[model samples]
Target: MTTEEIRAEARGQAEAHLRALVGSDSAVLRDDQWSAIEALAVDSRRALVVQRTGWGKSAVYFVATLLLRSRGAGPTVIVSPLLALMRNQIAAAERAGIRAVTINSTNIEQWQPINDAINAGEVDVLLVSPERLNNPGFRDEVMPRLAATCGLLVVDEAHCISDWGHDFRPDYRRIRTLLADLPPGIPVLATTATANARVTADVAEQLVSATGEQEVLVLRGSLDRESLRLGVVRLRTAEMRLAWLADHLAEQPGSGIVYCLTVAATQEVAAFLRDRGHEVAAYSGQTDPTERAALESALVEGRVKALVATSALGMGFDASLGFVINLGAPQSPVAYYQQVGRAGRGTDDATVVLLPQLEDRDIWAYFASLAFPPEQLVRQTLEVLAQAPGSMSTVALETYVELSRNRLETLLKVLDVDGAVRRVKGGWVATGEPWSYDADRYARVAQARQREQDAMLDYLDTDRCRMRFLRDQLDDPDATDCGRCDNCGGLTLSSSVTEAAVDEAGAALSRPGVAIEPRKMWPTALANLGLDLKGKIGDGPVEGRAIARLTDLGHGQALRALFRADAVDGPVPPPLASALLTVMKDWAGDWTDRPVAIVGVESASRPQLVGDLATGLSRVMQIPVVGRFAIVDASVAPGQGAANSAQRVAAIHRRFRLEADVPAGPVLLVDDLVVSGWTLTVAGVALREAGATAVLPLTLGTQT
Candidate 1:
């Protein structure tokens, strides 16, 4: 049948399915969902699902599967990133009287059901995790048989496979290759609630085949979540922040999800909120799937009015939520979107509030550190694929190694097309995957290629227009500004922030080539380093370079001269001069080493908090007032260029009238934020024994 005719028959079947659902009183779905079915008909084969986290993205495909059930197109294979998500989808499908089964690492034996269904042409759908989907059995044995007989290949959390996606999973990298293994001419329907334009393109490129124009189609929806109101707040202490959250719920009431960065924090916040007389529930990775299921049921049915959670909930079930609050700062826009979108499940109005502490930067940096392993991963895979025997296809490579921790996943894919290797029958056997090589010469070539990608990542880390940086790397260099990013909102960035006017521009090698001190870099740098920019030089590696040599030709007039001569990833700042300033100021002994607590961020009726703190230090200790200070995220980020973070923090220290409370060693403390009186208390206790004049703390956020 033609694609459209097939789509029509499928829709008719789906309507019957939904009608059966309504008769059984299974769900309270709206008419818009039916409209979605028609829309699917018009755009039959390829699909794009744009909905909130709880909008039943899975339902759309499940309905499609049932619609096409009569055709006897064998069983549909659903690929989900997480094991839990696959199970959830399977469970929900089972509830609707649909025949569904799942298999992951935990139950590899259950995969026989999938093979049985494909052979009998009876199973409607088989849900499996991406990891399990590529297992030796499914890949070499099960998949080839189900190829043309398969009905549909539903890819869940499709964004995760996109390298630019926030929750990029290493396993998801094999998605494109897996798609190639699907049933011939079977419709490919992909769904993700978190993909941006950049990620969308990545998805298409990876899935694009040697077919006509419709190889992979794109569908987009407005991200302007009208029911959600967005707000940002910066704070210092957990006690005050929890209390504030409690008050917020008291006023906003109903049901909400409070997302915290850690399991312990989620537990603590849940307890703290409960003690304050708020109905609260907490979910973490530690919670078993059954307990998680119960909790999800509670929130959906409104038994629990609030839930404090870590990022553990699977992405399959549906819910109508009221509010989504960020209890701690999120690491990236993608993560923020997923959490915030958990609210506003299409049936209700939802609000999103963000509570950020400067320390959260350190927390995010900690997560970024995980990507470090991908470096060794790429080189090793290339080497392995280069030598072996047959075709070096991703599936072949996957069979040899349990997992690919490879760094350049995209490049490995590119090599597959460039005739670097051929696709052999059983799996990939390498044909040298050869390159110009005199062993050492090839090594140099490999290093150069690595540098090229490194330069791109550096651009992501150290360039302005993070969105543009990513777009450029993806080959859509001319794409317009993505309106949702922090950059589009006009936040000045350290990446592109030039010295207002550089009179003495090209003067390099002036300052000592010291490693940048990375403590608390100004928000400008941290925000700048956020994922959109690619190339990033950690403060640690930014030690005095062997010497700035022109890659093309050596000498130039301004710093731009160095930039223009030969393209390099980074080197935008001087070392942290503030540490020296701090040392110099401390040696004078007028400043307190201990910090005073700051209750208010802006001014208050009572001038109790440290206000003239910077002026006081400058006048008393005679320190330079460089006026280059900016807000700094106090959280320590070991994943960052330590030197970069430290230098920026030092620069921040010099400029602003920060709320500082230092200890009383020989000097008074100067702190910018005081969430509670604890920092002050600690500083005061330290200062009193040391015999310093005082301890003070400073901050700039929610006053009352």
Candidate 2:
């Protein structure tokens, strides 16, 4: 058959597949979708589809998979990013009569069966997270087989493969290796709804065949979502934002998302909304996998009014979510666009509101602090790994390094991608390959991030069409005034929250106290650091209480003010003192034993506040002030408190000594703040060793 005749036949099959996939008798593929499908199935070329959400990007791949399989090609391998996305895709694939299975962290037990089915040619599409591609077992055993036999490779959320993208993941870089290993002429497709000019170019460049045998077909389109009505509500206080959400959430279109910048905010906002009779749930990275799935289902099925979430819910969660309200602005316009894109996907009208507060920049700074470490620190990490005899676990490496667990893990991933390290079954090992720190590249990225931040600020204050402004930030060539946004028309939402709602929100915020879960297990291999600690912390403090989290919406703001570097070291404020009394009262009410005395943890930064808190509590509880732990060695370096558990433990082990006499029985341990909790742990252990029966920890704030 002629090429045109063959294209016509393939187009007919694609329409049939599209109809089956959407369960619509009259459904047909868009011209762009058909173009992507044809490139993948007929031309066997690489394709990148950068279109708006709900624009049928998935249809292109699913249809292409069926077309390729009809000619006896192997099952398609989809490198998806999130579990929610995988679930959505699997369901969609089933609707199209395609067999789809997934192997993710959640479904480990099913991996063998899934692999067997794939090998038996019973699975038409196998979805796996990008992280799984780097797994030693999967990479060594399954990936090569899949790469050799796979008909088409799909990289969903392809923008993540580029470090220039708003939401970059190191694991996505593993796609380059997979691409290189693919059999010659195998088709590849990468799709994303959120990528600007830079990210698009980076992703498209990454999609080029290692052999230079095929050029990628780039299909870019407008990112305008016509159903979205964008607006911003500038609230002067976090309390006001909470109040607005409480008073106006139910009046919005349907059940939606209330996005918060921090996990503490999610919990606080969800709790406040629920107290106001809204059926909302809090979600964050700290939530368990099972609970996350259930919460996603709840939001999708409309079982709850909304899910107060962090960016953990940002990526491929599919539902006809009616609205998305940001309690705080994301750091960049790109991130804000990706998040707001979640709304109005399947509806003719959806509300997208951004509640920008003064605290948003502080939150952004906190996240920015976790970026790539300095060159010196990177060198130190490499030296530690190089000097090691075998693969070192992250916890073990933490003893010698000053980085936190999260930062250390991230650095290791970047190093691995740079070929300076390798991830093995046991842990990570130095690759012994010469690697140069790309200072210029990293600086450029950082500068780009700053520019994005500036653009987001511009977006918040822009008088032009909000949608158009965002699209322009994304380099959308077809950006135009939507005539639906608040800026284009008038303010779509009211800044006025009822007095009663404000008071209610204030009361909720005023209520403080977050449980401080004590450390149960010691950092592994402390012996390497000249400390003998290992295994469970048998003598550690029991569960403790903090007046608030440093990230909390209510008392947290005050606590943050009190803990700022430039803040005066004064006695506890009257309001915080009163809240502390309430916390103590509630805490004592549930205790099996009352504290016989108060002991203070040594405070280098807030000695006045910690000492004052201990004395005030002593007077209220009618207990003696047993005295405080002394800083035996004040020689520790600055910022040592923020190090990982092992380092913090080692630092505290040498610095803290119980210099005061302690009468037995339970005692209340007070501190200005609990960061790593190692200071409290060490104090608790020392007190327990000094004959205290039990130690109860109480702090003004806990750094989350």
Cα lDDT computed for each candidate against the true fold = 0.50, 0.89
Against the hidden reference, what TM-scores do the models get?
A: 0.54, 0.98
Which residues of candidate 2, in runs, are more than 4 Å off? none
- Model 1, poorest ten-residue lDDT window? 540-549
Off by over 4 Å in 1: 1-13, 21-44, 51-56, 113-118, 250-252, 274-281, 372-704
Whose TM-score is greatest here?
2
Candidate 2 lDDT over 281-375, as tens digits, reads 99999999889989999999899989999998977888998999999889999899889888887899999999987777778888778778899
Query: Model 2 misses residue 57 by how many Å?
Result: 0.5
Writing each residue's lDDT as its tens digit, candidate 1 over 1-704 gives: 99878655655667667655434534543444544544443444555554445555666777767765655555677887655566557677776677887767667576676566657755678877766544556655666665556677777888777545667665666556666765445667777776766678777677664364455655554444445545554444443455567556755536778888777567656766676577888898787767877888788878888778877763554566877777665655556666766777654456566666534554554455444223344445557766664444453353323232242333443344433543344444344656331346435534533444444334324425534444443334244554433344533212121231121121211221111111221223222223121123212111011111111011101222323325333322222222224433333343333222212122221122233544444554554332211224434321122122222223222222333332323333333232222233333333444443432332211101
